[model samples]
Target: MPLYRSWQTSHAHIAIWEITETEDFFAASLGFGSDKKHPKRRLEHLSGRFLLQYLVPGFPFDKIQISPLGKPQLADQSLHFSISHSYPYAAVIVSRQQEVGIDIQVYQDKILRLQSKFLSAAEQLICANDMQRITLTWCAKEALFKYYGLGAVDFKEDMPMGSLQRTTPEDALIDMRLEKTRETCQLSGLIQEKFALSYI
Candidate 1:
């Protein structure tokens, strides 16, 4: 599989790859061996390497650790990051001096099945126009969860996403805008009939 990588912002970098072939190459790119150990530990190791290569210098790959919730952290507490992956892609977002999280999902029918679990009643009412709205709602909520560093929180109860107005790519120069009772975040992406890609 080929890998596509780019810098989203000066302090933020994104690594996106289509994982159609195998996880071996992905693992190697993250500097992991095939040996089976602790999955969480291995993820931290990989996350560490990516951070050092792009953020720090002379840091040992194994020197980082992950929280029980699967968030990566430096054993020495120097950097912060989050990792996410979907069926065919994996992305890691890293920041040199701030907390960051990233999430990727392959838009699919499965999201519809869990709509009630994630979307707020207000969101549902606003998105009633089309089924695709449901997918975007889910993606937005998921991205919010990652941004807050709370994975899979009660999307309906914990982090309710308010109504969003879809802005043309040219109108706002951004993709989706998510609002909450207290804060707002921008999600950039495109939605097709089958799937969507969003970055927060």
Candidate 2:
């Protein structure tokens, strides 16, 4: 019931969950644990793993290994996944055939000031000072970074977002370029009143 929505892409399944349950619920249900010091952070950590198992039955939680770049991966690479959380919400993308990424971010006014660090001058202008657009842009690139799954990426230079193409009032498709791979990919995104979600 906590699963807010799930979208099945051609090659992967993306799921988002509204974290309405207590940490104990996840801890007990999944036999999962987190050592995060903060309670909310601890909850987010548990919920991420919970969503993974929810998306893929019998996910090998015990076999997850962290790469040198701190990306969690399966040694056999049997499944490629990315997990992200913004407090009360958590999301995951899983693909047995391809690396995947997903991100959910609660809108924050402060992102306006920090935009320069992650967004280039041109990318900022593309946002046109709109917080929803700004947040979606950040999420879009962040999704790309996770998709790359290698650290030391420049959000400003590595991924540039094109103008948003609004598919629906709440949903949009963003064309983003992956400088690292010299390829372009369209990130599917949704802009809500309080948050933005993106996946690649």
Per-residue lDDT tens digits for candidate 1, residues 102-190, read: 65566666666667776667767877735566766665666666666645566677655545556763111122333333555665544
TM-score for each model: 0.68, 0.96
Best model per TM-score: 2
Quickly count the clashes in candidate 1: 0
Task: Write candidate 2's Cα lDDT for 18-90 as tens digits.
Answer: 9989989999978867999999999999999998999998999999999999899999999999999998999
Clash pairs, candidate 2, are: none
